[model samples]
Target: MGCATGIVKYLVFIANLLFALAGLALVIIGILIKFNVSDATRVLPSDFGLAPILCIIIGAIVFITAFLGCCGAVRESTCMLTTYAIILLTIFIVQVAIGVYAFLQIKDQNSFYSALKTNMEKTFDQMDRNPEANETMHVIERVLKCCGVTGPEDYQTPKVPLSCCRNIEVQCPSPNNDVNSDGCAIKLQGEIEKNSKIIGGVAIGIAVIEVLGAIVALCLASSIRNSYRRHTYA
Candidate 1:
């Protein structure tokens, strides 16, 4: 019993310690997103503007709450552990709610993609005029192997960029040739959905950890109390 109790205590401590670090990483990521996104909000459409702000909020909450959880585990305090459990549960619920709301609100993918396509076409045009200025867009086009947001036709002059061609040395796709007809919007949407799923999975895993931490804390607290009671009676 003594060894088992000790093992539980250490396990909780190590788990919470790791969680504290994860929380800090999240906070840093959130801050970076806020700074980076703030600069691009002017150019980007309004629909995705709030994502960065939400990241910042969620990150800050995770950092603070995770710190508390770490402290509760280290000190073996029942009250603090309980408080940490409640806070984590609340955050988990909020995360799930936000995801569901976003999914429900953005029902029509095509319209959103259309607006994004317009934006991409403008960026491509800018890149054509001055490659250095729109270097990022050029890189994305090349990396994604996509010509435009919707299709190559989205190019104003009915010409495909060299980035969209399978072999730059051979020939670039033109208005008449539909070699690289894949739309970047679809690829971008797929990447976003994939990343969201990853984030959701990680969140669910951490929530499970949080539940275990709370249960262990409560059980350890009870064990400690019982030990004390036995000593007092003896």
Candidate 2:
């Protein structure tokens, strides 16, 4: 009986660990979603465009894992808990890989945005002369202006990188930000921060709670298995 309880405890431990890991992952993703790309020198990445959606989905999964882990840990079931723990570990590793890849992607996006901005600046005048270039430049400049930079400023300072456009206070996606203030700049910085910070930070937290839950499960499983072995041998 004592051994059995120990085994069960091991299983519970594994589950708890997995769940904690999952929860951590969720918060990380939530953080990422809130982060702003303009200041980060990164535009919305093409490949990572779906990252926010994926984080939300993963966060839900982590929350569910927490619940399951809590249940298994309380029940002290070795085999079941062990299975959960193993699964959580696997997911955790995968999440780490995804995080690394995402960071790399952000770097790549930053570089790309810089290059694109430079090229755009160089060709802005030509755009007016060429119909296609005109349309493209008009659209691109509009986005830049909306994002907070003065298009004319770029002409004065050609040495500045793409990020120079970021300082201009314009209408961001945040609800509270009023684009029509004095210079079409954003207001309510707190609101802006909350919404922007969710992107990169949240993306890093996938499967965190699940890892914690797995740890809890491991404890429960160990306890249960030990107990079973002791009784069966006796």
Candidate 3:
């Protein structure tokens, strides 16, 4: 029994250490995505824009929960182990929910694309009169390295925005060779789809890990409680 308990204790500790590292990786990924998408978020749907923040929050929770599990394992505290298990179970449920949401969003990519295209078109049309729209479009075009909603042709003017140029150093709105012929709508949709897939995959994977962690925590807690009971009776 002692040897079994010792093995379980070390297993719990090692599992939690891995969990902590995973949590930190998640936080870093979230931050990178947040910064990478900051310019595009201006036109993105509210739910899509919130994904990075959700990732950050979940990562923080996972880190704290893993820390608790590590301490509990080292101290052989049944109370802490039980608490950790409950928290892990809760996180697991939340991660599954997020994963499902992300996949559903991916499944409805056509509708998502349509909505985004419409939004961008509206923004482009209003750019002449709306200062905010103009600024947003400029940032989107420059960062995305694309032209108008559909392409430079979408601009009725003979000279498109300088941002449409593949090389701003050269004379823009000139030959096709100097311009970015791709459409912003397509580029933006591709980015969103890629992000959704990533979020779904990562969330599902972590949820599986969380379930295993919860099971291990519960088993460890049970073992510790039984050990205590045996010592008292002896």
Candidate 4:
């Protein structure tokens, strides 16, 4: 039983080390994406963007907590293992709550579509007022292959934006016949939902793994305590 417990401790340590590495990678990727988004939205309010930052923060927390678990498992320390288990359990609960909230929020397509359209119109207004915002919109349109909120007709211009041209070289001379009729809002919404589902699924999966880690930590801690008690009595 003692040998088995020792092997479990090593397994926990290895598993946590891998998790720590994964978390670190996630944090780095999140930070990079956050910087890109921040730069693109430089004219927008700091408070207006938070998703990437939140992702970075969460990844950092996961890394820190998993590293702690790894250290606890290596040292076979009761206090450290207890702390590790508690933190993992808390994180798992928070992840589950966030997943549920995201699921609920995304379930209503009509409300989301309406809200997104309104937001896009507001963004269009902002782009008109700010040159930097206009540049950002062009970048978005080119990347997303979308013209305006609903379609190119939404823009009150004689010609569609060059970024909206299907043939890249042939900037549409007129919106009436040249521009693609697809709305950016629908494409943007689809992408947002798809990414959200992927993230939520990953979080839920990690949370389940965290729960298992916590249970293993607690069991190993108990086993170590019993071993200590037996050696003391002998």
Candidate 2 matches the true fold with a TM-score of 0.48
* lDDT (Cα, tens digit) per residue for candidate 3, span 169-208: 7657544788888889989888767776775676678678
- Which segments of model 4 are wrong by more than 4 Å? 39-48, 176-178
Top model number, TM-score: 4
Provide the lowest-lDDT 10-residue window in model 4: 39-48
Q: Select the stronger candidate by TM-score from 1 and 4.
A: 4
Candidate 1 residue spans exceeding 4 A from truth: 36-47, 105-133, 168-173, 176-179, 231-234
TM-score of each: 0.77, 0.48, 0.79, 0.88
Ranking of models by TM-score: 4, 3, 1, 2
Model 2 over residues 30-125: C-alpha lDDT tens digits? Answer: 557647332222222244346566666766766665556666666655656676678778778887787677556444644645444544444454
Could you report the Cα RMSD, in angstroms, for every candidate shown? Answer: 3.6, 10.2, 3.3, 2.6
lDDT head-to-head 1 vs 2, winner:
1
Candidate order, lDDT descending: 3, 4, 1, 2
Best by lDDT: 3
Q: State residue 212's C-alpha deviation in candidate 4, in Å.
A: 1.2
Total clashing residue pairs per candidate?
0, 86, 0, 0
Residues 1-234 of candidate 1: C-alpha lDDT, one tens digit per residue:
378877887877777777777767776776787775454332234667776766667767777876776677677676777787778777777777876766654445776566666665566567657644366554666777776767777766655667777665665647645346777767766665567678778767876776776677778777767767788999
